[model samples]
Target: MAPAATSQKISEKDDLDATIKKLASLKPIGHSSYTGEIKSGYSGSWAEKLPETTKARYARHGVDISKGYPYVPEVDKIPKFVNEAYAIRNEVYPYVERGAKADPEKKALFGAAKEVINLTKHLGTEIVGLQLSDLNDQQKDELALLVAERVVVFFRDQDLSPQKQLELGHYWGQVEVHPQVPRISEEFNGVSVIWQDYYRAKYGLHLSFKKAIGGNAQWHTDLVHELQPAGITHLHNDAIPSVGGDTLWASGYAAYDKLSPAFQKFLDGKTAIYRSAHQYVDPENPLKGPKYVEREHPIVRTHPATGWKFLFVNRSMTVRIVGLEPEESKTILEYLFSVYEKNLDIQVRFNWRPTKEGLGTSAIWDNRASQHFAVWDHEGKENRHGTRVTSLAEIPFFDENSKSQREALGLSLD
Candidate 1:
């Protein structure tokens, strides 16, 4: 009697499986599989497919469109949308200003400077009426803190000599010497000259028209190939073009924020190989034994001061994710690179203009939290020359307990 009952149950299970398979194989009625065309009997109303709760919510929002093909708000009701938008603006503006002013460190330098304007929500600040030489020890300390927190700080109309710029860099850390590039002069004390034409001729650093015209430009964090890359870079442009020589900086913290949680987790445990073979070369001796410097660093590094995680890879320096297949590395790196390149919301573009006193602009940026790209748009037209001093700091490290930029700043993830 037990064997008979088991056989009946098995037959019923087989019948149920066959019925399920048959249902799965069947196509929707009045829909053509080959042409993707709906027959005459099909109404093609997607609204009807929505759940009743969704329909009710839409109705509650005054979005009833069942009576007509296209839904439009009445003329009298259009003003409500405008009023709601203004209401949202009023609600949001204070929070933005509050976030901008939340960093109390800048207030320490309030007496030394005239104005401190935050260039963007996340990065870059321009300090007016403050010269490098004018800063006292306390003001310099506060300025260092501001630069570390803001990632980049700008100064206008300042008569800062090459010697003074080097001194400013030394205030933060040891002044870095370029591995390949030469110093400006023996008198200037470790200031590297970043003259466009001179470097192009001296180092054979030729720029192609194809590269300039290409819509996608590369960005880099300075000296990522070195074992200990530069931390704070002070670039004082002595000469710039009359027009069209702008530099863009993307926030590394914002770049980290753009990644999904799963992707971020995957990246946190990995290290990437950074190489600078193509970018830098010893011009005097072309056949140097070691052509480039290579270093491996964590894919996501934490800022020591801010206690925030930031994306460290750049389009120019980062070569491959270690331990991954070539194709897999290429696919992942390309996507990660695009997070900074494609998102303009997380970037700030600075257009260069000489001061009335004929002094060029000086910008100091933190290499760990920012990547910069110099737009070579003024080729053969104007000379864009500059002197830069890189200050050495701590080696890149990742702390698992560090909060993200958004988390640290109390910003919305959305």
Candidate 2:
């Protein structure tokens, strides 16, 4: 039987003629239209060239000059403080590991409401079966301490609304309202929306650009450009992609431990200038509406609750070290930045997945002790939206008397 014909009829011959005409009229788009030609030879200009004296200076500072000015050899020799820190990390890991992998009967409970499960040897821990509203005063205090020491804590299938999330943030400290960005809801001024679709449209950003300009695809501490940056950040992902969009956090304590004792001591007295570059409006434009603000903070800051020192400089916000020449600061800052970038063994990567009940994962991280990077690989595929509340805390300070994380954890130097 023949199918019923519609009022509009398609003609194959006419369509073929149109397609042929369009193809014949098409102009060639050269490669140079999108990208510049690649230069084969390097310019030997003084600014572009590495001087012998500069190479020697970097070599004296323990850099591998043969590889390059900023390169450091990956030697098996471990720093004494790093070894001690790891010994401490190993000792604490067993208790957390036992708790994480233990039977349901043997799991450690926090105030009869939550079971603690360590996510990594250092950094993150998952507190299962806990509601923000259900936590008592004692539990809230303990959770604050836990987050301070662990750097970040995770919760699954949380039923926390914006109001409850604000309340939970208040238990630790004052809920921070972002100075520049607006709130997710006008009624709930504390919560900030982190919707990818909204940001992409708002900022006119595209995924094709490889530069770390508009989006947060790089590791950073929250609002380091501010004098008193947010101390803690709690994010609740309501919608996520089927794959990718996982967040990775690196321990500032571990990053600090990887440095040599002499280098660490050198950095103790130094401060770095962190500027509001990527987050502020029109970072690249000099005449942008919002002006950029810069803040200077110690390269190594002590955790007030834990009394342990951790690396504070981040590649995203840190511009230069004070008291050094621009070139010298660039070389040194690049080296310090590589410590966090290269040390994957000291980091934890979390994969986010929502539960069957439509309740997604919520993460609370101590921004003072850790840096995080959002994987932006899920662009245009799915929606990744969330609400965040940042908590205000004290200014970053270093106490000379404070012990290293290793020393504070009671690990022997040997």
Candidate 3:
């Protein structure tokens, strides 16, 4: 006779079955109705009151932040989700796990793509033929491998809705819900609103830690302070300007290769301090004012999927190298920052232009192995808006045996 089913396994299966039923019941929220502040930077306490212009802009999305959170008029209609959400993280079984072999021919991925254009030798790839929403299970797995290999991948003119986008996030891994961050709606807290103008207004003084040097500021990885930081991050820009707004991504793998063998040897296994973009008050020492969410991680960390070591430091969040004095750490950190910032050969600039098939474009990147900077050149004058979903992955680790991407692929720095 077969062994009796354990209660835990039986419970998980029951929950999974119930969750599937609930999802089937969830109808497509009207595209426009997908609007509102389920939560946001605007929802919290702030110093400078929101300008009427910003408030008016957000109100169009059903966000009446005028009174604060529970911002929607029909908050009662929004079903309580804390219990439902835990299933995705705890029981649904995280997919696209680390340490899997990559599919080089990309039979499943490019089999559907019309034109696979390599944006640069090291950094970006644009998969022209595929629609993100329509990807099958096999195609989705290949897509994750492609992102790891290319550092980032682009999709043009996709019809991915907010709900479908959130579903995709769940398929990848644990969808991160940062209660403090600005999101599209309460119904979908995982979908973060990426409105530059409004976000700038919300975080004033706190944004200063990201000061510029050689005009190289704001290059960062998401949620590095979390025990398990952001891994595969999808940013779908449903709205963009006619010209002037582009995002730049630097390949962490290429940055590692730029360093000499001696430098690479020194950096390997060394740890550095990374802090959160948000700050919180230290209750024990109220006199200190506020403190950032900080974590110490390897300066040179390995990407589990690719088994390659990449420089993990970012100019914005990674403040200092561990075990080093302040001045010593600053000097070394700045040099490493420049390695990522100054190397044009290791970077790709993507212009978010969309054809008639969709509203805008999407860029899905492996935040664990790349850093991106959004060009704010539009001066907040144009409609450059998007929603991002960041999936939390493994706590970072440095494997001394991991190879550099260039070395592993037999590609020269030249």
lDDT of 2 by residue, 125-189 (tens): 88777776677665666666777778888887765566677887776666665422334333555
For each candidate in turn, give its C-alpha RMSD to the true structure in angstroms.
27.4, 23.5, 12.9
Q: Each candidate: how many clashes?
A: 0, 0, 4
Model 2 quality (TM-score): 0.69
What digit string (tens of lDDT, one per residue) describes model 3 on residues 262-315?
999989989998876544333344344335656788999998788889999887
For TM-score, candidate 1 versus 3, the one ahead is 3
Which candidate's TM-score is highest?
3
The regions of model 1 sitting more than 4 angstroms off are 1-103, 213-217, 277-291
**Superposition TM-score, candidate 1 onto the true structure:** 0.70
Query: If both were scored by lDDT, which would come out higher, candidate 1 or candidate 2?
Result: 1
TM-score of each: 0.70, 0.69, 0.76
What's the lDDT for residue 376 in model 2? 80
For candidate 1, the per-residue lDDT at 334 reads 97
